[model samples]
Every structure is written in C-alpha cells, then in structure tokens.
Target: MTAELRGTWLYDAHVDLGTPIMVGPTPEGVRAIFPVTGGRLEGPRLKGRFLPHGGDWARIRGDGSIVLDVRALVEADDGALIHLTYGGRLVIPAEIQARVLDLANPDPLAGDRYYFRTLPLFETASPGHAWLNGICAVGVGRVVTGGVAYRVYAID
Candidate 1:
C-alpha cells in the first residue's frame, strides 16, 4: 500500500532552520553537488533527489545521486516518528562509500529520551572508504527552538 506523506510544514521549517540556501561546489570534485532543484513533499513523506549542476563541480563527479526520503508520523502533541533513508553512489568510476541506513526515534520517551536503531545492512562499492563503517553511529535528537534556527542536540 502507498502511504500519504506530508512535507509542506517541515519544508518551511527547514527553510526557517537556515537549511543552506546555496549550492556550493563539492569539496571533492568526485562528489555531486547536493539539494539541487525541486525538493518537495510527496504527501506525508519528503522525497527528493539532488544532482550536481553541469560545471567543473560536475566533471569528475560520479553518478552518485543524493537521495532523501523521509516519512513523518505524529504520535502525540509533542511526539513524532521520522523514518529516513538516504544513499549516494558513484556509478561511472565505480567507487562507492559510506552507504548508510539509520532509523531514528526523535522523541522516544515523547519528551525525555531519544533513541536510534541502526541496521548492519550497509555496503560500499569499493573498500577504499570502508573505514567509514567503524565511525558510523545512529543519532537521534529533538528539534529545540533557538529563536532563530532549529537546534538539534542529543536528548540523551
């Protein structure tokens, strides 16, 4: 069954949160520029794919596309569950690394503790960046109001 995801409010929130208003060149020429054009809500889920613009930044850059797919489900007045999955790949030269899938409960206790569950299901197209595996951690945080931008800190 297809789920209805909503992203308007959160999209605005991301804007107010100062979600990088510009697309700069990638630090690594091999990487694609992110958050391209046309990112919006597909119902209750936030779905978007970004690609590097055609330029010097897009040269050595591989076919690695940045994928952002998220689903939001509200639990209570102040609690919510967000399921997110994202991945990047380099198809041309065949170099992929740091593929991550993390499940986060931003409001586990609905107020007190935040929790995260990470699946061991991760792989790299090449071993050159395999070291990224050991340094990965599933993180969870609550969006606290900072009067300016959205602030996310470890809840516990």
Candidate 2:
C-alpha cells in the first residue's frame, strides 16, 4: 500500500530576532546566535504571541547553507503555553548572498533567491491543544526586514 502526504495549514508565525552574534568559524561550521525578541502567531486553531528570550543557534556551513536550531514558547490566547522547537536549513546561492551583502537595504521580496524550511515539533500541557503533541509539522520561512516569517503546516 502507498500513502499520500497531506497537510493542513496551521499558522503563520512572525518572529522578531536581535542581531546575530557571530561565534566565528568552528570545525563544523560558522556559528552564530540570534536572540528571539518576541512576535505573533496567528491561525485558525492556534492564536497567540511568542514569549521573549528564546533564540536560534545557527551554523553557516562550508557551502554557505545555514542550519538553524530554534527554541521558543507560544502562549495561546486562552493562557495555554506551548513549547516549540524546530530545526531547519537555509540554502542561499552565492550570487544571491553577494547581492544581499552588497545592498544597503536587502529586499525581502528577493526571498525566491534562497530556500528556508523547517521541521517543527510542538509540546503542550494544555488539554485543549493537546492534539498538537501527536502530529508532525513543517514550515517554510523567509527573511523579512525586522525578522523572519513562517507559514507552518501540519502533516496529515
């Protein structure tokens, strides 16, 4: 038997981050830390905002791709707190990276020049949204002016 992959649009997360703190190049890659300031989360089933103090520990690989390890908290409108963790990769072409670096103001509209995606796992103690713990989720992201935006989907 074969299985078909299906997904449900879960939410759009607008996450703000502080400037990346460069950790310099390591044997694995060039490491950096991006502090999560705060942001909003909106969708049909889940609606809320991200709590501050979370962050992404990123590594720029030898080939210029980015590996992202992120952790955050989301507080639902009803006061339920959810733990969010995701790992993703950002593949940036050299030409596009050069263009972005050369520009005084990088255009977020040029997001098509690169690919950013993540596999997110959620954990919650709230009974109302407990179903989330059992399902797998994925998200597509883009770098915006002040932060990153992600459209998350639930694998069904």
Top model by lDDT, which number? 2
Writing each residue's lDDT as its tens digit, candidate 1 over 72-94 gives: 22111122222223222212212
The TM-scores of all predictions, comma-separated, are: 0.18, 0.92
Q: Using TM-score as the measure, which candidate wins?
A: 2
What TM-score quantifies how close candidate 2 is to the native fold?
Answer: 0.92
At residue 139, what lDDT does model 1 achieve? 23
Candidate 2 regions with alpha-carbon error over 4 angstroms: 98-106
Alpha-carbon error at 3 in model 2, in Å? Answer: 0.7
**Model 2 lDDT tens row, 1-156:** 888988999999999887778899999999988888899999999999999868999999998998999999999999999999999998878867655423234466566668989999999999999998999999998887667889999999
Report the C-alpha displacement of residue 36, candidate 1, in angstroms.
12
The local distance difference test score of model 2 is 0.87
Error (Å) of candidate 2 at residue 136 is 0.6
